[model samples]
Target: MTRNLLSILPVLALCLWLCTAASSRLVKRSDDLDPLEAVVSQLSQTVAGLQAEIAALKSSKADNAVLLALQTQVRSLQTITAEHKVAFLARVDVDVAANAPIPFHAVDFNVGNAYDPLSGIFTAPHSGVYLLSTQIFPQFAGDVLVDLYKNGGIIIRMRVFDSTSPTSESTSITDHANAGDKYWVQVNVGGHIYAGAHSFFSVTIVFPDS
Candidate 1:
């Protein structure tokens, strides 16, 4: 269809003619003009078929390039949508009494506004599978029991009791959530639960629920 493609046809013809001419001499065992002419004619038909196939391939390559570009755009849009996420990290200066909830004051990042710092609750914006993670720092060597709540129900519960030094405890879980579902963490049993910049709560949509 294009001039560039048309040009290849002539080159193929030339190569075929040369090949036939050489074959004729070897087959006929003589440079007789009549035999060589017959061989060249026979090769023309075969060369023409190859040229047509080449043209079809060139056309197909162009079409495939367009499809690849469209796929790339779709993948880019998916990545943008995946950014519906929220992460909060802070040190609670106020003492979170035992058997109470500790509301984080600092919000490191809430790109989707799903987390409310004042309320310390993360509300899902859409129905999807979400990955939730939390890290806590307990300062004293005592019984520590923390829990994560999903819609006022306990979904994740952690218990640590030791007479040693302070240590960190963390939990990660995935959940299928609906729009407006609330999730939060609370201290179940711990006298001195120290949370600081290292402590964090995060949630991200792994995939939308179908």
Candidate 2:
């Protein structure tokens, strides 16, 4: 009877040890699963943060592109504005008989009566410094006086005497003339100033820096 009791006690102890080992394995599995779940949650949060940063970068890139386009447009507009400015040159000629007064009245060009007919009057075509010159051909020995007037005032007066054939005199007038500024010239006195058909005086207006 004693031997049988010992054998039953050994079998009971072995069954209790197997049950304790199974319980420890289940607890360790549960602890490992908790840590894995926490890792997966942190990885999901990090992915979301990266996605937000990518979106912000895309927005900044778009803003920079828009600014660059605007700058290019501004430069183009400035170039066009510079090209739109108007600049031009004009030439005019007036012929007169020697000793016979040749009148370039301001009223003829619709400028106004700002000049006297007896004193040569020439209307400015545009605002600029004009180089005025006169060429005269006389049949006999004579003298020629060329006068320039501006704003109803005498600006310069030039004279040529003892001229038998074609004679020329030139003078520069620095004047800020509008589109309708008045100017003129006249021959004061000359001997036998008018004889041949070719014997006459001519005036020319030129722009020095056209």
Candidate 3:
């Protein structure tokens, strides 16, 4: 029994540490953190159940069974975290032209290769509901109007009027897209971006098609 307890002690300690680390990151409300939060919830429940089972092993000779269960649970958690993640955040640092798509050349991340930096377009890799957002910032004192296009149709529009200082406007839309469908941001009224990280775009799958 002493040897078995020693063997399982390290596994229990590692699981407890992971739970604490994951719990600390739950304060932020971000779309990208959704998957991590789900996994954390599952791990927390698993840890609780394992603790209960370990307590019951004090009077039973089920040490091998308990150790096997812990190993299986740990493997399950590893697999969950290793799944493919699809998301991207891109920003435009150069000036844009009117009636043209804003080329977000600076790609911070492109997990699924759905976003093309050369043409400033996002093609869906999977059929699902997506949450898309964009921000427009004017470099000079002028009016800036931007449109979010889904498959060549306007879905969301943002307008910013900067008379004295640089200002930005942002908006988001939750819509459905099929695989290979395109989404992009275009300049409707003005095309002059602030030329920095202030003007940006991001998209992520919220609910995949089942």
Poorest 10 consecutive residues by lDDT, candidate 3: 77-86
Q: For residues 63-111, could you state the per-residue lDDT of candidate 2 as single tens digits?
A: 9999999999999877754533322211122444544345532222322
Expressed as tens digits, the lDDT of each residue in 93-157 for candidate 1 is: 55466665567777766767888777678889878888888888787778788899999999999
TM-score of each: 0.69, 0.35, 0.60
Which pairs in model 2 have colliding backbones?
A: 120-184, 120-185, 121-183, 121-184, 122-183, 122-184
Worst 10 residues of 1 by lDDT: 85-94
Ranked candidates, highest lDDT first: 3, 1, 2
Residue runs of model 3 more than 4 Å from their true location after superposition = 1-84
Candidate 1 residue-pair clash tally: 1
Model 1, runs deviating above 4 Å = 1-46, 49-76, 79-93
lDDT per model, in order?
0.76, 0.49, 0.80
The candidate that wins on lDDT is 3
Q: In angstroms, what RMSD does candidate 3 have relative to the true structure?
A: 23.2
Q: List runs of model 2 lying over 4 Å from the truth.
A: 1-121, 125-128, 163-166, 191-210
